[model samples]
Target: MTSAGSAKKVVVLDYGFGNVRSAERALARAGADVEITRDYDTAMNADGLLVPGVGAFAACMEGLRAARGDWIVGRRLSGGRPVMGICVGMQILFAHGVEHGVASEGLDEWPGTVEPLKADIVPHMGWNTVEAPADSELFRGLDADERYYFVHSYAVHDWSLETANPAMRAPRVTWATHGAPFVAAVENGALWATQFHPEKSGDAGAHLLKNWIGTL
Candidate 1:
């Protein structure tokens, strides 16, 4: 068993995005030596990085851009470091986000768009089970009926990811539905993201965070 002394050092990025302190606390509980910082160097050098966000995609992107969050993420990923994105932090990694007819550009790391959920209700709030892929390490040992917390109106509807590496393993993309199916979590190499707020998901969330830290 891995010891706490060997636990990964994780940095929760604070680019003025929402729920950072909670994320730091969650990662710490997950056995990571957590630090909450906006310092680019500290973020880039950490064994793992956590990016948490809330609110509109455009507002989150504005904050990310102002702090050059993309650069830090890109550089770390290029070096094979680990990074996990939560909620809008995950949303802004896509190509675009259309909220109220306003289309704002995203990080373009994935080929997709974030739009309103086609549900009877506006925001899909509460706990929901996710359908994870067979090869998923993030959901390892998690119960098949495990549920995560979610509170959002917008989500990525498209599930296509364009990659040229023919030998690459199929990216693990978890899905959950409100009115229609939407991305719940994605584990793609060095980049891992969850549309649900794992920090707010309680015990199940703690297990998920631990799983991600295991990868680091």
Candidate 2:
């Protein structure tokens, strides 16, 4: 349990991924005592762990595996610990990532595939709105039309998780589309992921981050 008076400790995993400093700053703004570290204990014992990523799917997966990030994320989630993934970080949580005719394995925390967004545009950059479900804690306090920053070509265009565990609520899936529909966010038990970068998403992003910190 945490309070406004007591800062929550969060680790922004540094596994040769995305912008750690920006992520740290965002979490700090959300009242978290954030650290950019790969220390085993620090990562596993933190109140929450944020996995951020940018660039190609296979390349990010390569870096993540080099640091055993998949294992760390899995271990934490299995114990009911909180974990969030952003951008390519979110993509790696699925089954496989197919890019440039190459398929790369992922964490498989959820059942799905990450492929290029089917649009005339490659990277779906800039601020975009999401239709988050009414019951989503990650989107709590966020308006239906609130916009968040996005920067990517690859994403989970098709969602595969429709049912929840016996004791858990149904997975709250959010969607945003470019040329086709894609998974923008997901909330399943202890695992939370966002295809959009809350760090770069202004006030809407801050609210989302705060909502996640509240769960910690």
Candidate that would win on TM-score: 2
- Scored by lDDT, model 1 comes in at 0.90
Model 1 worst lDDT window (10 residues): 1-10
- For model 1, residues 180-200, the per-residue Cα lDDT tens digits are 999999999899999999999
Instruction: In model 2, state the lDDT of residue 61.
Output: 90
Candidate 2 C-alpha lDDT tens digits along 46-95: 99999999988889899988888878898999899999999999999998
Q: How does residue 106 of candidate 2 score in lDDT?
A: 88
Candidate 2: which pairs clash? none
Q: Clashes in model 1: which pairs?
A: none
Please list the residue runs of candidate 2 whose C-alpha ends up more than 4 Å from where it truly belongs after superposition. 1-4, 164-166
How big is the positional error of residue 176 in model 2, measured in Å on the Cα after superposition? 0.3
Candidate 2, which ten residues in sequence have the lowest lDDT sum? 159-168
Cα error, residue 87 of model 1, in Å, equals 0.5
Q: Once all C-alphas are superposed, what RMSD does model 1 give against the true structure?
A: 2.2
TM-score of each model, in listed order: 0.95, 0.96
